[model samples]
Target chain A: MPNPTAAMLVIGDEILSGRTRDANMHHLAGRLTEHGIDLKEVRVVADDPRAIQEAVKALAGAYDHLFTSGGIGPTHDDITAENVAAAFGLPIGVRDDARAILEAHYEKQGLEINEARLRMARVPEGATLIDNPVSGAPGFTLENVHVMAGVPKIFEAMVEGLLPTLTGGQPVVSQTLRVERGEGDIAGPLGALAERYDALSFGSYPFIVNGRFGVNVVIRGQDEAEVTRAMQDLEKAFPA
Target chain B: MPNPTAAMLVIGDEILSGRTRDANMHHLAGRLTEHGIDLKEVRVVADDPRAIQEAVKALAGAYDHLFTSGGIGPTHDDITAENVAAAFGLPIGVRDDARAILEAHYEKQGLEINEARLRMARVPEGATLIDNPVSGAPGFTLENVHVMAGVPKIFEAMVEGLLPTLTGGQPVVSQTLRVERGEGDIAGPLGALAERYDALSFGSYPFIVNGRFGVNVVIRGQDEAEVTRAMQDLEKAFPA
Candidate 1:
């Protein structure tokens, strides 16, 4: 099977405002990787409907799966559901199934579900609900777009519930070798090694550790033996 | 004026692969806030030219300023200059001024200015060069799109060089009050305070410290006195 490509759309002005350091992206990245889904792109847009629609359409068309976070709240800024509906050209209303889920969820908590909270039941038409175990609001999957909550806990729960249903490929395994050397000095050898191991992806991340330059050489691939061989060759080329 | 809206496009597959935890977004967010520029969006794209072009055109048109990082190196995957040029419908080539800068830089380093190395000198037509003190490879300013380096050190240097040249509004000042309370408990009062201060932006960040729920109430505005007053009010409302 071809690579399972994925894209993430993070919808919230709060993230861009630096008010919130998003944990969902990291969570999804790791999970998707383990599921053999290569997350190709990540776009963090505001709560604007047009922006959301444009991003949803563009990303959903390009990638095999599109994961969206945020803007599924009670406030006016919560426009992802409506915009996503428009993107897929689907009519949106209070989904009976989602309503049932939310009602049951609230009933268990003995909480009064008012109009403000009931707004969470609204979902795009003909969409399968992605269960939110932590929150009452149900995320929906429409044409490969998985819309989840902005809150990390809720988003995580939704992902956990959703992942088991999807088909996945052999997960990419990776190992890192830390070298106490500058990137410029190691760039030539690293480039050659990357060219040799065309199947595996290699990355050289440079960092300063206590005023000393160091590079972390990462080797990633689906084949564990091939990745190990490449790592061995890399170690031989640049012995610690 | 008009909140000085801006957007950031991070062009790299490394970030999505979790090869690197991003420092650019946080640094840029802080800088933009200090410059009174409200960053409305942030997109992380792969090294694909089409993705780069699409994101640049959309964001540049929507925002007052658009900042891009990565995909402008000497490597084959570094197509940011060409993509950015395509976004603006401008021809990309090695400009004389940029070539001169690179030539001088190379001469000082006693390095050969090959076709591969000269790739760094290529800039979109009708663009101004951004100074890079840390690295010889200079970033460029094309219209409102600020093409910056991927390396954190170089990116930060470019930002420092560019910040003073741009027309900045009154710096946004922020005051944070850490209260020993859960967000649910403080949500009501925080919402009221947010309404009371129409000129300011307010947000509640909730975190757990030592198994206790704690909330940090942030009040941000241009007026120092007003922000101080708000902080004083918060202190009075929730003493210590």
Candidate 2:
């Protein structure tokens, strides 16, 4: 059976405006790949309710899983939780369980659970809370959609808590061969080799280093033998 | 008038499979921000023709401009050009101008223009070529969509070449204030300030350093005076 497909929806204005470089997407991509979940697509949208809602609905419906990062905070710009609720037609309010978690966390630190802070406790109906070990704010999982915080440390922690629970398929293995020639020099043979190995996925990443053009040919497959064989063929096709 | 909105479609299997971290999206976001083009959305899809075609069509139709990076090479996985053509119902073939450019580039490097290499010359009908100073395989602009190479160096070069020709709006200006308190401590006052200055966009990015939690409040607006005033209000709301 094929691996369960997943998609990511990254919600933040800091990312859209280029004020912040997104680290969560790359982190999730690596983690999902290791969990044997195929991350098929990723979308980054600003902190707009309509955009978040639309992306959440579309990705959640299309894939077996949808993981979202960002906009789940205490500030005014954090609207992801509400928008996610709207996407699934679920009524959202500060659930007692979530509120209790936040209240205890704040009480421990001698901090007040103000109105804006209480916003972080708002949870969509019929959702299970995902543990956030790094911070007090908890992430939530509604159906197949997992919503996590945007902070890298907190996001990574939430992912660690969430991944082991989900079912996974065979992890994909990849091998790469760096060729010291321009892509144009190897394209013909590389193309022919890719056609021969129908099971393996072939990717060519071009790079120019020290005024010398080269390509890194990456061969990936769920089956290790198939990937190895494809790599062998690539080496033969472009002998050093 | 509002700034022209843009979206980016990043095409590559390397990115989805967690083999490569995408740098082009961040670079484009920063550049587009400087050019006063609001980058509204960004999508990263694997090197699949259907995904590419669908994303290209959707982003192209919805936004004022669509910029794509990746899969524009000579290898078998380089299918972005063809898929982009299919999205617009444009017939694709080896255009003489594009072929000539590639042929000259290869000749200078003492390389052969093989069948796979010739694939780089395929251009969609009624499209204009975007210059690639680093390598010869030219990116193309079809209507409002500009396709560029995925390599960071080449992609940056293409963006530099493309930015000058397009019209831009007033650049957005932003200022940030770092507070040494947890977000929960400042959320109430920050939310109230955000409500008062509706024109400025306020974002709070929380961080945990040395076991101490803090938040960086960023205020953005096209109007400098409005942003400054909002920052002043934020300082007053959370006096040190």
Candidate 3:
């Protein structure tokens, strides 16, 4: 079977303005890849209902799985659940299951589940809750979309809870070779070699580390043999 | 005047899969601060056209300005321009201005502008081009959205070209103080200080660098004096 495709939606205002550098996208992406899912895309949208709704609907339809982080807090900007509900054409209201979770949480801590805290109880209809053991507020999954907290710690916990159920494919393996050459110099030859190895995916990332023009060539594929062949060809093309 | 709002769309498969750790969003966010534009949202979508279209439309409507990076390149996955045009219900064709820019670039390098290279000329109708002096394939600004190359160097150059032309508010002045405390420990007092300064924005980014918990408290506002005052209060609340 083909690799299951996934996309991530990072929803927050804190991340975009350089106020926060996101660790969630990187963490989730690595996890997804290791689980044998091809993470095809990610979109970082602000805490806007419309933006979240539109992104949720589009991504949910396109990929096998869609994951979202952020806008699930107790703050005014936390509108991810409502937007996801709107995207699914479902009503937004406090779910008893979610409320039970939050109620128990606040009760244990001797904290009030006030209007602000109770807001976390709101969940989309027919969505199954993804348990957040770290914090009281539960992450939820509906159809292909998994909506989790923007907080890195909470997000990781939910993914750990959900990974076991996923039917992952053969693990996608990769090999990287560093070449001291400009992308423009290597583009044509690399493109030709990439074409020659149709089974393996080739990527060229150029960087200037310590004032030297260097390119990191990555070859990825599900099949180990095909990846090996591609690596051999790459070595022949640019020998050390 | 209030701070100008902005959004970013990072379009790439590599970023989501952990193949690339994105630098563009962080770079753009910091630069936006200098221009007094509050980058309120960031979405990293894949190379998928549908994903790109949805993200672009949503951000363009919500934010004062939107910046998109990645997929505006010379590869099969480079569909940002086409998808962006579709989002706005605009026509995309090989634009004359873009063609002229690419032609000049190729002419200088004595390289042929092949069918593959010519793909860069396709741009949305009614979009003004943003010059990329490094690569010479001009990025375009359509409506409130700025589409630029995904390559870090190219993206940086394009942002530099566009920032001076944008209508920005007073540059947001910021001061950061380092406190060796966990976020939970500091969350209460910090929230109170933030409430006191209604005009200024304060954020606490807690990290465990070298096995010691430290929270970097940042205050942002137009007035340097106000920002300084808030910082002083923060210091008093959580002294060294």
On DockQ, the candidate that comes out on top is 2
Q: Can you write out model 3's per-residue Cα lDDT over A110-131, one digit (the tens) per residue?
A: 6667766677888888989999
Query: What lDDT does each candidate get?
Result: 0.82, 0.92, 0.82
Which model is ahead, 1 or 3, in terms of DockQ?
1
- Each candidate: chain B TM-score: 0.96, 0.97, 0.94
Q: Give the clashing residue pairs of candidate 1, or none.
A: none
Residue A196 miss distance in model 3 (angstroms): 2.7
Interface root-mean-square deviation, each candidate: 3.5, 1.0, 4.0
Rank by TM-score, highest first: 2, 1, 3
Off by more than 4 A, model 1: A103-110, B72-79, B82-126, B170-240
Pairs clashing in candidate 3? Answer: A41-B46, A42-B44, A42-B45, A43-B43, A43-B44, A44-B42, A44-B43, A44-B44
Quote the positional error of residue B32 for candidate 1 in Å.
1.1
Two-chain complex of model 1, DockQ on C-alpha atoms against the true structure: 0.35
Tens-digit lDDT string for candidate 3 (B1-240): 788899888887688778888989889988998888888767777667787898788889988999988877654446788899999999999988889888898888777777666778998889999998777778999999999987788899999999999998889888999998645456667767888898976755545566454667778788999999999888899988
Superposed on all Cα atoms, the candidates' RMSDs to the truth, in angstroms, are 4.1, 1.1, 5.2
Q: Any idea what lDDT model 3 has? A: 0.82
Please give the RMSD of candidate 2 to the true structure. 1.1
lDDT of 3 at A99: 93
B45-155: candidate 2 lDDT, tens digit per residue: 999999999999999999999999999998888999999999999999999999999989988988779888899899999999999998888999999999999999999
